[model samples]
Target: MLTENVHIAVPTAFSEDESLHIQGTIDHIRSLYEQGVKSVLVSGTTGEQHSLNLQEKMELINGLEQEEELMDNMEIIFGVSSIRQKEAEELAERIRPTKLAGIMLGYPPYVRPTQEEALIYSEKIIQLSNKPAILYNNPNRTGFDLSAESIIQISKIDLVVGIKDAGSKEKVEHIKSDTHRNDLHFYAGGEEELEEKVLHGYDRLSSIAGNISPAKISQWFEKMLKQQKVTTQESEEIEAIMGQVYQGNAIVNVKKILNQQGIPMGICRSPIGNV
Candidate 1:
């Protein structure tokens, strides 16, 4: 269930303290697609979407849809996270006008609950949207861990096709092992290189590093997909450079590396607070 292309997920693009030029966001995504990104996700945590107001989020999604270039081959997945179900559903409905490919949702202050509560939340989103759904389970940020059983149960609905696995190795293994034969697809989040989840056997990868280091990141991702291993030296350089600040938050280092290579990734929306 590999729902995205280019195998990278750039989370937290705009920091709260920073100023976001609406045109800047669209240009950034368009540039990535031209660089060979098959799919691009907007308004996720990486996009700093939670920090945006409801109207702002709508504007962003609508803007992307209007891009004739984006409407062609690139798949754009909009983040649908909200403090309440009604607001979330409203966002989903708003997305109907755009050709948004998918919607991703995770925990929020207003909807914290046990697995059953989460299941209901997921169902409501699926029924409300025409686009596919991505269930984000980054417990470190979301507070409550979304159980694999919860995901599997919810995934029974056709819309919930993918899960962003941001849990620890043990948790990931359980879900991967459990869903070995299911229709549910697992999306590897964060530092895919550091974790080696791709090396260990996950076929699909979602790298934030891909933002700035499109060519290099794509090379490694393609290599990994092909079962080819980069030298420890090559891998180490990537990690040391991208594993820290100034690139795009945790991903800024990666952006720095890319900037060195001649890409136009200006800045990470600025201040980079709490990336």
Candidate 2:
């Protein structure tokens, strides 16, 4: 079982020429590990996984494999999603034998498959990876919403452990009431409106802001989960951090902040940071 309550969705590093910089990515992850961060999600939306080709992703995975300390010590979850099901399947298979902790299985963007098709896609990837799965459903981005019925059905699969951005409070409650599983975790996608999310039964965090302020964000989230009050000073600090991360494009802002800190996160792949 994936045990981390919070995981940083890290950005993939790109060179000046916009090439994948595998070492740079690993270096940032190493920095987080050194800072007492126990888990991270690579190649998710923050990692710009859609911008990376299969070959580059394979290279990145291989690079992570070589980092024995990080691989062995952290619950390093990888993101697996592609417009093509075959590509996602292949990627899942590649991760099947890896030291990777688990997967953030996102719905395919643009194609917007039907509920049945989406369920099939989810099951196939979950089967191939044979790892704990956190189903990611972003209707705004993917234009395909996984209904509560679908969520309940998918949650029955033992490999399926959780769901990210699983929708509003009512939907989450519905799923909770309908599903028989006791271990399913509800992960708020980012730090935005997080207090409300936690109140609404979001028990886990796939954190974007944590990339920049891992300890602070994690601590703040822990307090929220515990129903503890955040001091005024801490609240102000979190507001500042949220502004830095959520202003403009979040991925771009995070890369810039990380680069300033000397982690060599580089720039977002073209079009994104293309000023």
Candidate 3:
């Protein structure tokens, strides 16, 4: 059982006027490294890819590779989600030349395409980009479930390398039983699941919780890998505090966490509001 380090899919902090130009974001990426993050995912859902225009999206991708800490140690995954297949493929192709670690594509949000349709979408993206892509199968966020059968079949294509999982125990188990290759990576999200999921052969975690309390997130990730039993010594505490902060002001709490560490932290976009 080889487990990779956790990845912080950071949410971009914007300026007051719906911009993600703050220096605090890059600074935060550095801070996350200090806390034991092995990878950084930019322009993903956590990074608010949905909010930014094409230019802004590319800028965010550019920023991650520019940071020294991120450039060297961290594996940077460009999370590209779009309503149109051609658009996602185009973005994937354009950034292939950059120092991007890989591509992570979530299911197109607006339309719930059938599994076959999704496969075609992924195939076209691969054909267009000719770069490795991570299949981001998050059903809770995407509406329809992307099946393991589809993913395993898609894995035959050289481009689809991994998946950021958001399915249930059974679904994961199904994939686990079906999937056998080491090149294909599977990362889990959500805080409560860290301990349990790691035990069950998950390779990595692309965590939102890892953002605010990365030290704790790192501890949990390592403990889950090395220690006999999982420890929630830090996880529970951070969640309790962040839970309140999240309720009142997620943006402020995220910013405070980033600023405390010296990242290019700033405000959230308009649609996101205070959080």
Candidate 4:
């Protein structure tokens, strides 16, 4: 089980020439591990997953596998989604033997498959990975919303442990009532409107800002989950952190911050930070 309440969705590092910097990426995760972070999501949106080709992703996985300390200690969840189902399936198969803790199974952006097709895609990837899965339903980005019915149906697989950006409060209520699985977690994709989302039943966080301030972010989130009040000073500090993270393109801003901190996060792939 992915037992971490918060996992930083880390960005993949690239050189100035935009080639994958495997060591740089590993170093950032290692930094997080040193800060007492329990888990991280690699190659997700922040990691420029789609921008990475299958070969590059394979190399990244190979790189992570070589880090014995991190591989043994961190609950490293890899993102597995592609416009091509075959590519996604192949990624899942490769991950099957890895020590990777789980997968964030996302929908194919711009493809917008029907509910039935999405369900089938979900089942296939989950089966192949043979690991706990967190279904990612970012309709705003993917153009395909996994409906509450579809979410409830997919949650039956047992390996499907959670859903990220699971839509409105009403939708979450509907799924919660229907799924009959009390264990199904609702993961807020980022910290935006997070308090409300938690009230709406988002029990976990796929944190972006945590890439910058792991201890502060994780502690604040844990307090919120426990219904503890955030002190005014804590709120001010978090506001400053969010300003740094969410002020610009989040991925781009994060890379710049990590770079400034001497973590070697480099930059985002072109067209993202290009502007």
Candidate 5:
């Protein structure tokens, strides 16, 4: 079971010429590990997974395998999705033998596979990877919404532990009420309207801001989860952090901050930072 209440969806670092900077990516992850982040989601939307080809994705997995300490300690959840199901399967097979803790299985964007097709895609990847899985539903980006019924059905799979950005309060409530499993986690992606999402039944977090301030974000999220009070000072601090992160392109801003701190995060793959 994936036990962490929160995990940072880290960005993939790239050099000036837009080549993958595998070491830079690992370096940032190691820094987060040092700062007490227990989990991270690599190659997710924030990591620009869709922008990377299969070869690049495989190279990242290889790079991560080299970091023995990070692999052993952190719950590193990899993101697996490709327009081509065959490629996704190949990646799943590749991850099957690694020390990776889990996978965040996202639907292929643009293609917009039907719910039945989507279910099959989800099942095949989960079975092949043989890792705990988090179903990621981002219709805004993917243009395919995994319906509440589909989510309930997928939750029956022993390998699927949670769902991220799983639609509205009604959908989440419906899935929770109907699913046989009680431990199904609803993960709120990023810090946007997080309190509302929590009230509506989002029990876990896929944190983007945590990349910059892991301890602080974790503290706030825990307090929110437990219904604990936040001091005025903490509220202001969190607001500032949120503004710094959420005001614009969060990934670009985060990379810039890390770079400014001398972490060598470099620039985001072009077109991302082009604006």
Candidate 6:
């Protein structure tokens, strides 16, 4: 069971030519580990995961496996989603033997499957991966919303631990009320409108801004979870952080900051930083 309340959704480092920088990605993860970050999600939406081919993702998993200390120390969750179900299944099988802690299972993009089809996809991947799973619902990107009823049914599976960006407040409430399990976590995708999301029952965080300041983001999110008030100075500091991150193209900003700090995060794939 994955138990971290907040996990950094770290971006995948690419070289100057936009090839996967496996070592650079690991280097960033190592830096985060040293900075007291306890958990991380790799190849997530922030990682430009869809841009990565199956072979590239497999290579990344291979690279991650070499870092025994990092894997042992951090709760590493990998994103597993592809436009093709067969690829997803193959990826799940690939992840089954690794030391990765869990998977963030996202819906197929563009080609929206019916709820029943999505359910089958979810179940098959979960069973194959044999690890804890977090259902990722990003209808804006995937063009398929995993309905609250579908989520409620999926939660019955012990391996289905949580849901990320599970739609509006009312939908979250509906799912929460319908489900009997208390361990089902609701993870806000990023820090955007997080206070409101927390107020609406989001207990966990899949944090994008944490890539730049893991400790600070974790501290802020913990306070938010507790509904504690932020002092004026704290608010100013947080506002500054948000300004730096959320101003434009968050992943691009993250890479720029990391590269400036000499972490070799490199550039995002084409069109992401084309501006």
Tens-digit lDDT string for candidate 1 (79-117) = 887767678888878886667778777666534688887
Q: Which segments of candidate 1 are over 4 A away from where they belong? A: 1-20, 109-111, 176-182, 192-195, 199-201, 240-248, 251-275
Backbone clashes, candidate 2: 0
Model 6 regions lying over 4 Å from their true place: none
* lDDT of the candidates, in the order given: 0.66, 0.93, 0.70, 0.93, 0.93, 0.94
Q: Per-residue lDDT of 157-190 in model 2, one digit per residue for the tens?
A: 9999999999999999999999977899999989
Number of the candidate with higher lDDT, 2 or 6: 6
lDDT of 4 by residue, 69-171 (tens): 9989999999999999999999999999999999999899998999999999999999999999999988888789999999999999989999999999999
Winner on lDDT between 1 and 5 is 5
- Model 1 deviation from the true structure expressed as Cα RMSD, one decimal place: 3.7
**lDDT score, candidate 5:** 0.93
Candidate with top lDDT is 6
Question: Where does candidate 2 clash, by residue pair?
Answer: none
What lDDT tens digits, residue by residue, belong to model 6 across residues 1-275? 99999999999999999999999999999999999998999997784889999999999999999999999999999999999999999999999999999999998989999999999999999999999999999998889999999999999999999999998989999999999889999999999999999999999999988989888889989999888887888888888899989999999999999999999999999988999
Clashing pairs for model 4 are none
Backbone steric clashes in candidate 3, count: 11
- Cα error, residue 35 of model 5, in Å, equals 0.4
Native-referenced Cα lDDT, model 2: 0.93
Candidate 1 vs candidate 4, TM-score winner: 4
Whole-model lDDT, candidate 3? 0.70
lDDT for 63 in candidate 5 is 98
Q: Score residue 270 of candidate 4 by CA lDDT.
A: 79
lDDT of 1: 0.66
lDDT for 48 (candidate 4): 77
- For every candidate in turn, the CA RMSD to the true structure comes to 3.7, 0.9, 3.2, 0.8, 0.8, 0.7
Q: Which candidate model has the greater lDDT, 3 or 5?
A: 5
